[model samples]
Target: MNNIPFYLAAFLVVLGVLIVVHELGHYLAARFCGVKVLRFSVGFGRMLWKKRLGQDRTEWAISIFPLGGYVKMLDEREGKVAEEEVHRAFNRQSVGKRSIIVAAGPLANFALAILIYWGVFMHGSEELLPMLGAPPNGTPAAMAAVGNGELVRSLDGQPVATWDDLRWMILQKAVDHESVVLEVVNERDEISIRRLYLSAAGEQGWEGDALERLGIRFYRPEMPPVIGKVVANGVAERAGLQNGDRVLALAGKEISSWYDLVTIIRDSASRPLRIEFERQGEVLSVDVVPDAVLERGQTVGKIGVAVAPGPKPAREVKAFVRYGIIEAAGRALEETWDKSVFSLVMMGKMLTGEVSWKNLSGPVTIADYAGQSARLGLDYYLKFMALVSISLGVLNLLPIPVLDGGHLLYHMIEVVRRRPLSERAMEIGQQVGMSILFALMAFAFFNDLTRLFNG
Candidate 1:
């Protein structure tokens, strides 16, 4: 509740940036193709702001709806065009030019995603190493004898450096193969190969957390219950708890590890806790009440203190992932292309009934994710934006009526027959396309509401 304002702000920022980028693509292409653009809008419906700009006196606008925008070009099909400016109208352009103008919007989205990914890859961040914990009984990992504290070295002969790499490799293989071979190094320094079956994982259609379905979990290192940093004016700081304070116990219960402290504090929200701690060589006690906050519809306690870094080998669990400029660029392109294809494949699966429609997310779900990723950190937020950008590009490129792809499809047919479709035929196609789009939107919105209420 306290973060609603921040969340809304984040969602708006994401929406605004992506919409501008997408519409700018169409606007630029229209200009390049010599098609006179009459208006450049960042949104649709009621206009909030408008300005005439450039030699063309194009009406730039910010509108009420945030989900979409457009580049309205001078077209005889839409409205009357002056006799002098008819030469520069969109309808007067060649099939090739019109196709380029229509395709530019989605291409711009892809380019933006690529650029963002390139910068992010070069900047890098600390990533978790793919170390496995004990798998639950009857799971694939357990059946394959995957040990706790086993660090994954490779998947099907491909080197796996970070947890993301491992997960990606696994997901790619799970789509086609029944089993994947993994090379792992256990905590005892012993290395072994384990072939884990994926057929029973039930992740063929890419359902929830494929890794979790396969019983893959990260190995959590136990750290001493010591405070690394204390939030100003928080319960811990108010109770005289400072950095380097080792918590000895909480509410008469023993606290050996940071996880133990967290478990106790979370269960004792709004309740006064008698905390025993050691500051240097001096042992002391303090009465502190944990702040109660709602998270995912559940109340949890927060003391506002950061955990100290784990000792020795536990520190090796993280790797700073960075790449050179050229490598980063290549990786970014690869990432964008891969995600685009994956999205298309998933959409195809949805049409075939292999994937559930529940996976469709509307603006509400997207806004929630925008808020979440923003809260996670800048890197996470940027990555989330890039992913959404890819999705936007792919969605726009889908060959349904009323989309950029639909226009491109029309252009393709015109190229084949050497003539545009008749007005009545185009109108019928538009009606059918709109119906399909509205049905999808309604279903997606229902899914969003279901998730909210269920949570």
Candidate 2:
């Protein structure tokens, strides 16, 4: 109904793959530790397909809801088992082995992220150059003396090659009278320097503004717009637009590049305009009506067409590539550590009300983001999956009952006290865990609902 079949398919596939990887970690660890795995499932609920391999049962099922999944291991606490099988139950395992098994799932997620990031790097991912474009008038960057075409070499003397690196550096730095230096080179190759002071007051005032206000923009090379794909039944297709057609002008205004055409169309807002183009060395003109669409709280016009690849600007941008088997594993380990730390800090900030709870998202928000990213490309989807996987791993590691962290915490207490927790105590902990989990879910759902209604 949403015409987002690609997004839906991509999200489901990515999520399913991540779930399988995570469960496999636990299953393999259990087997290695002499604990038996009862079932390894990609999705919950009824089974669509299943197979039994030797002593382990594997299921590939389409659950009614594809939000999450789990792996079930044999445990003596759940039910009675044969005398021989009792030795293979999860509860009978050593504390060290149990910890390893419980920790493996999240570690697998981290591994997946590293591999994805490595792949992104090896394939050369696109990144905007660290050039300070024209900041909007009265914004912080403008007031801070940042100007058009000024190259941002560093933040606090830390060299930044890409826009993302600069931005992350700024966000993490303490914004108290920090001096920002700029390295500018004019057309004649004349070098000059400018120093500006950063203040918390100034930064706070410019909050909720575009990245451009923070002195950032993509360095796009000038190129004529060539049609890539013509959508069937869309405005461009109906107007006789074809692939490889070079856009020349719009509404009688001469257009030199794709940026110029985009500006004109966005400002047109569903108005019918004359579009001039060249097809096979023959010039032609057609009337096109731009369709208005709302995105990220702004209204823009679209023609439902893609532009062909053009020459990129001569700027040294940071690029990462896909990882090899060995390199991916190593990078995965590092990424897991970094993401775990970041997640913990964010959680702390959220709890202290330093960050807004509106940042919390549920399934609805996830699906929308997934759809948007999927529409962009496979790389975008992969990045989203990596981030989501990291978030999932971090969340499951929280010291809340019924979670891996909670179970680990209980084991830790048992080791210290020289005895397991009482059954009544475990039951109470389970109830507390459920209550806390349910509340978090409710809050996330409410946030999503608010966003939907507000939009």
Best by TM-score: 1
Per-residue lDDT for 265-334 in model 2, tens only? 8888779999999999999999999888776334578887787887664444445534466665665566
The regions of model 1 sitting more than 4 angstroms off are: 200-206, 222-293, 296-315
For residues 224-317, write the lDDT of model 1, one tens digit per residue.
8999999998999998999999999999998988877998999889999999999879999999999997774357899999999776664378
Error of 2 at 382 (Å): 1.9
- lDDT, candidates in the order shown: 0.88, 0.72
Q: Estimate each model's TM-score.
A: 0.83, 0.74
Task: Single out the weakest 10-residue window by summed lDDT for candidate 1.
Answer: 200-209
| Residue 172 miss distance in model 1 (angstroms) | 2.5
**Clash tally, candidates in order:** 0, 13
